[model samples]
Target: MTDGPATRYARAARTWAPIDWWKLEARAVYERPELRRALAPFAPVEAWRDLAKDVATAWGILLTLSHIAALTLPVLAGGMLLGWLFQRDDLAPVGLTGLLAGIGAVLAGIGLVTEAREPTGTDPRIGRLIGGLHLVPSTLGLLVATLAISLGSADAPLGVVAFIVDVGVGIAYFVLNRGPADSGSDRGRRNLARLERALGELPPTDRARMEADAREAIDVLELRDLVGADDAARAREQRLGLLAMEMAPRTDLATQRR
Candidate 1:
């Protein structure tokens, strides 16, 4: 009696296959320089460069929550400082009120910036306008900090320090979101390494079939940037693994009919 397709696939997967990685590595070592030289001409037009840009953009968009948190903390701290300034019994009401107003403007400006960058379906023009309003907070924070220092309020300085730290964090966050230019390449290498390890164990036909199936799924998932470097290979492997479960029952039904 002939085995079913699933049985055949399983048997193919368990069959011994000899692949000499050490020899491949040794060959690569010997030919590394020449191979690099041969490929140098195409380096300028590598497809990975464009892929890297898309990956970075996707990474940035995914980290919007982090960006919002980073920006929000400073605004909150500034609000507290303004509250302290107005509550001060020692300082004259007029000067303290003026300082409070300045802080208000700073908070409002940052709020606008936050709203602009908020992940929502808002009017693009309005978002741009709000984003442009960030200069208001940037300039206001400095001025208000300077004023607070001059006013002899310790709270204002602390608030300004938090604001500065938040700004620094914001910059770092942006850098991270942009990711390194080589990020996509690094991710690709890791994915390829993982897939090679996984499919290498399977027979050639099974391996090829799995690769084709997984590639289609990966393309669909990656469109929303869901499958990124972090655990993407594992996720792909899991998805492919699930395909066996999906097929197993169908195979059993076919066997019953036979």
Candidate 2:
């Protein structure tokens, strides 16, 4: 929820001609004060910074589909597999009246995980205790759902429901996951292009000054020479480029803190 360099990039991306602004680096080299000051006349930097916190909270709460699916799909699929493997013809049709109670259980586990990690610290000890308590029911819900389906009690009910849930979860997963995965390198190039275009329209003097300031700032802030480029530290800053905002919420916690 804190307003750091990541927050600035995320918000600035939205205003910068609908590009995948999240591609902007959180490091000071990309978030240099001089570059920001140069662009401030074109943006509501303060207002966006204030909204950055809420936006980040919203992101953690709504993590697109990839992260959720990683944890949920396996459980749901395992439930279906168990149900199919153990189904009985003797089960009542009335039990088939509806078919989705099982789907809700997956939410229980992850929801508890979110609140514990939520950014609040008024009472650390109490928070930790309460957070752990949430897991009891979280585990219970999944356990019960698993048992019900696999034992044939919820098979008829969840027979088709499993497919629905998995497909829905699958489609959501794929759509959300569809984006550049590199550490914004590609996006960084695109952003650089956009910035270049903007600068192109400016007078030579102002453009020179702004570029000079940004270059100097990057020179000072850059750690490229300071640190070795191993080519495999492995960081991925998330989401589709142009269409990212359409499918996923802009307030991504993972990205906002990048």
Candidate 3:
């Protein structure tokens, strides 16, 4: 079974129908590997593991709330315009502008949702191509919104609609560069390097044996985290401890002979 923010969102959607897609998308960003990797460089090692988990669980809540406001403002503005037009018998002209703006908003939202679903695991060039294609609706919405705003009065309903689309564009731009953090494999490589360097000080036979064991261990191990106090961290610690234990017996025998 797939496990990730997207999957969780799907489950939630099934359980609780009619959720705000923008809010879901914002919340889901925390589950993306790219966001974790970006934050890793800045987070302290002592708290990194907990921090990553907590942030993933709660980071986007406020942004999602803000997304609701952004989404609502345009709808409210359009509704108010419709009410005023009803009072003046001018609903036809103003209603068409609102309709166009509404269509643009829907298109932009669909595009944003489509773009958000593209996996970060895809090849960079192919990902970019797919992302650009997915953004076509948003780009068109932006143009339509601009036109709608220009054709309407100073209190145009499309103003807030345009702003929402602008925010969607910004989100897409931000996510484009956010790819998964390769820190797990990177840290594994570093640990292996350190082990090999230490082994170089040992006698040829011991060095060869220890190096082979370490290589095999490194290749077989799976760690969700390379640092901090977590299960993956503990596993890595145990692996290193086992390596040290293997070295100790030979080192002691050598000292006795000396």
Candidate 4:
């Protein structure tokens, strides 16, 4: 049976499953002086950029929780204090309101964390739902706290300013936690481009063999329907081929020209 482009590519992709493409890309980056110079300004000095991504995700979750606590804790404590000090019959209402607001803030924080952790191919509707929940509840809780403070305090102007600042911070946090909507495939294509450029500078025969290997990888990745199939694979293969080619002695004098 003759394999179609998709099938062929799939088989090719399977051949290199054990290899670490990121590590390979890193090596390529180091080998090509020109690429190193070009990328030096933008690329960080960290061992792995993926580590930074993971850390950022962790920080997002932590920060969301922190914001929730910061916004709700004072209100809860104040409710308890008012109940103790005034012995007001309305203390029950005050405490209940504070407790509900705190709970909502917690839920919002969780939603934001979930949205941040969700993988690239997560359902768009689900993501939007989580993101909306994350934003809405926290906003509502902030508004409630602001109103309550304004009503209870003699310093109305100060209370109003505090409310505005609280709302502003919540809005900023929502914006900060908003995850990028691009698919994993888009990211992969960009990485492939960098790999390709690195491969292009290697010796000719090494470049050719790497090109072949990369084609196999692309076939497996089904990068064509994603399109740029051949080019992506060739670029990766050429980069890999350079290492293999370096170990073997060259036979062709004509190889020096191109």
TM-score of each: 0.29, 0.29, 0.25, 0.30
Model 4: lowest-lDDT 10 consecutive positions: 249-258
Q: Name the candidate, 2 or 4, with the larger TM-score value.
A: 4
Best by lDDT: 4
Kindly list the per-residue Cα lDDT of model 3 for residues 115-202, writing each as its tens digit: 3442112222433333343244334434444544465633444344544454454355346534432223332233334434433444
**Order of candidate numbers by TM-score, starting with the best:** 4, 2, 1, 3
- Superior by TM-score: candidate 1 or candidate 4: 4
**C-alpha lDDT (0 to 100) for residue 113 of candidate 4:** 54
> Looking at candidate 2, what is the lDDT of residue 186?
37
Q: Which segments of model 4 are wrong by more than 4 Å? A: 1-15, 27-134, 153-163, 169-180, 183-233, 236-258
Per-candidate RMSD, Å: 18.2, 15.4, 18.0, 14.3
The predicted structure with the larger lDDT, 2 or 3, is 3
Model 4 misses residue 127 by how many Å? 10
- Judging by lDDT, tell me the better candidate of 2 and 4: 4
Q: How well does candidate 2 match the true structure in TM-score terms?
A: 0.29
Candidate 2 pairs with clashing backbones: none
- Give lDDT for model 3: 0.36
Question: lDDT tens string, model 2, 142-212?
Answer: 45455566666553544444334433433432332234322243332333344344444555565444334
C-alpha positional error of residue 147 in candidate 2 after TM-score superposition, expressed in Å:
16
Model 1 lDDT per residue over 186-224, tens place: 322333343334334455565455445444433433454
Highest TM-score scorer: 4
